[model samples]
Target chain A: MLKVNEQTRQFQSGITIGELANKYKPAADLFILNGFPVAADAAVQDGDSCTLIQKDVIPTPDEIDSFLIARHTPGIQTKIKQSTIAILGLGGLGSAVAGAMAKIGIGKMLLSDYDVVEPSNLNRQHYFIDQIGMLKTDALKANLLRMNPSISLKIIRERLTESLLPGHFSNVDVLIECFDDPVMKAATLRSVLTEMKTVAYVGSSGMAGFGDNNKIHTKMERPGIYIVGDETSEARPGMGLMAPRVGIAAHHQANQALRIILGADKGRK
Target chain B: MNITLNGNNKSIQEISSVLDLLKSLELTPETVVVELNTTIIQPDSYDTTNIAEDDWVEIIRFVGGG
Candidate 1:
């Protein structure tokens, strides 16, 4: 038995690919056997699935986007597009994480930030100069929607507290702690980890100064808590949070979030 | 008495409880999470949890930047 575009058909041994193509009378000159391109002279084996695509057929722009994304990482687009994540802060880390997740086609996101965009944020954050003075959540939502229009964004413009986390994160699959305050970060993390034990938490810790970039890492702090960065560097008076290292940490958090959602990252507790 | 604090071996005067340890370090208990002997000591329990000799304690605080 064979599957032709997911339909069952009787398997015919010794049938050349040319014979199968002729019998099917497909409009295209090429056959994709189980997602692999095959020539007309190739042998057709039993239990093979085939798809016929016209030679030199150009895919639409949107189709090309899907094809390229799926080609690079097969079976990830669908799953990523169905997963929901909640980003607790919308600063450099959260903003970049949101953009990265949206680009990967995450289904939905819950973004919370109370501050407005400032000129200082342009160095590493995902906002443009024109967006300065706009609420971080609104700006981030606009930016994410612009990239992936179909994404579901739940924007919260108030300061997040331990009390408010559970209510807002009821439907999210994972929690991302992107706050700039160590106090708030600890508070939010403790609240989420204790209240939402089932949800995975990806956080940033030590992304500061122009220190060793290689030191930045994603480590499973506990069973459900994952922290990215060196876990040592602190922003000091002379040292500052530059773009390169910050982006690295943000992407690390974002990547952790993606892998957790896809079941690719199982933390060692 | 001696205890391992945040991976560093520290020599401290005898302390009655986790709260005493935080007070000696000048750290407000509200700002950090304490892990004693590989177990997280909750903030509410810090006052009552006694500090034992050679205890492995991790004092984790938040990083202020993203």
Candidate 2:
């Protein structure tokens, strides 16, 4: 039995990937055996899984969804596609998180950022050089759409006050706090934890300078509340925000969001 | 009075409310969230929420970074 593009079929023993492609998908230009890319001449063993890709092919939404489902662990993509994540800031952490979630095909995202991209932000943020001077909300939305056009986005280009947090993110499954200001971060976390008891909250504390990568981590402050980072490294004049540490923390938050959405963080109070 | 702070047993003096605890720890109320036992203490109520002996308190302080 050989699984090709998520469909199982019986094939003659001693068949090669090229032969299988020629018989199953004649237009396939690339072949992947198991999880790694393989050449056309690669041998296709019985009970092996293979993926055939046609270059420049724009698959339909259903095809794309199927591909995602096939790539992820069993039943993971379905949960990922049904979850709604809200990011409160669009700075270094938020931008990277949004990029990760978009790549994973999150069902919807509520992104809020009041600031515009500046040259200073390019050092660590996900924005490109050309995106400078554009509102972070608009710029990030454009970038995210390019990555996954089918992702639904609701972007707000305004500073999020504590009063607005509940209303804006009332329906989201998870809320990520990526603000650069400590006051804003605390306020947002407090509001969400108190007002929106059902929504899982992932907030960042410290990802500054070039410290030990191992120091960055995810801590569940309580049930439905997670805080990522070293808990102490604040961005300052001497120790500035760098790409590697910030990205590490950002991905930690993104991963935590995924965990909450996938129900891996179940059985907590 | 003895209270659990961040999962560690600690003894403090004259800490009556969440605000007093923040003041004793030198953390500003604006930059930290106080969780008493398991209930999240709102910022406005920090001054009025009293701390009892052997209570579990988690004070999460935020830093200036994304």
Candidate 3:
């Protein structure tokens, strides 16, 4: 028995991958044997898994999903596909977080951003130069779809206030706060931690300046509340937001979301 | 009086409420999230919530940036 793109089939005892591809899927131009790319002449044995890829072939949604599952760690893709994540403030941090989540095949995302993509945002954000003047929600959605089309998105094109948060994020498994304003960050964190106690909250504090990357860290302030950053750096005159440092913090938030989804954060509270 | 403030044992002049505690630390109420005894204290209750001795208080100040 052999697994081919998640479908099991009985094949000859010792057949070359090229022969198998010719017999099973002749259109396949790329071959992956047991999770690694291999030459066509690689041998496939019993109980081995192979994924055949055809260049220029548009895969179905199920095919795309199956491919993602094959690439992820065993038994983790299901949980990732079932989780819904909410990202507030689609700026440098939020945009990068959304991109990472989408690549991991998150089931759904609740995205809220009221601002448009400006020229300055191109420096650190995920938006392209042509996306200038477009709403961050729309621009990010377009870019994310290019990565994973099956991801479900709920875009809110309005500023998030304390009163508006519960209605938008009450159902999400994890709520990530990515606002750039200090006041908004404090207010949003207070609202979610106070009102939505069941949601795992990840917030960012200091990702400004081209300082030491080691200074940025993910600290679980309390159970269900994680803050990632150096805890002191602020974006002001002389200390500005750069890509490398901001990307570090954004990926920290993304990894925390994954950890929470995979139950790694459990029992720590 | 003595209390654990931001994970540091600090001895400060006696204060009454959360607002007063903020004043002692020089932190503005609107700019920080105050958690007392593992529970988040709403901003509106800062004037009414009291800080008992040995209470674990975690105050996180928000700085501008993504």
Give the best candidate by TM-score.
3
Please rank every candidate by DockQ, starting with the best: 2, 3, 1
Mark the regions of model 2 whose C-alpha exceeds 4 Å error after superposition: A12-52, A267-269, B15-17, B37-39, B45-56
- Model 3: per-residue lDDT, tens digit, A34-104? 99999999999899998888989878778779878878855899999999999999999999999999998
- Using DockQ as the measure, which candidate wins? 2
Per-candidate Cα lDDT values, in order, are: 0.79, 0.90, 0.89
Per residue, candidate 2 scores C-alpha lDDT tens digits across A1-269 of: 88998877896788999999999889999999999999999998889998898999876677767777877954898889988989998999999999999998999999999999999999999999999999999999999988888789999987778898888887889999999999999999888877887888999998999999999999987788899999999999999998899999999999999989988984122
A165: Cα error in model 1, Å: 1.5
Please report how far candidate 2 places residue A78 from its true position, in Å. 1.3
DockQ (C-alpha) of model 2? 0.81
**TM-score of every prediction relative to native:** 0.74, 0.86, 0.87
Report the poorest 10 consecutive residues by lDDT, candidate 2 chain A: A260-269
Q: Measured with DockQ on alpha carbons, how good is candidate 1?
A: 0.51
lDDT comparing candidate 3 with the true structure? 0.89
TM match of model 2 to true structure: 0.86
Report lDDT (Cα) of residue A40, candidate 1. 81
Q: Please list all clashing residue pairs in model 2, or write none if there are none.
A: none
Interface RMSD of each: 1.7, 0.7, 0.9
Candidates 1 and 3: which is better by TM-score?
3
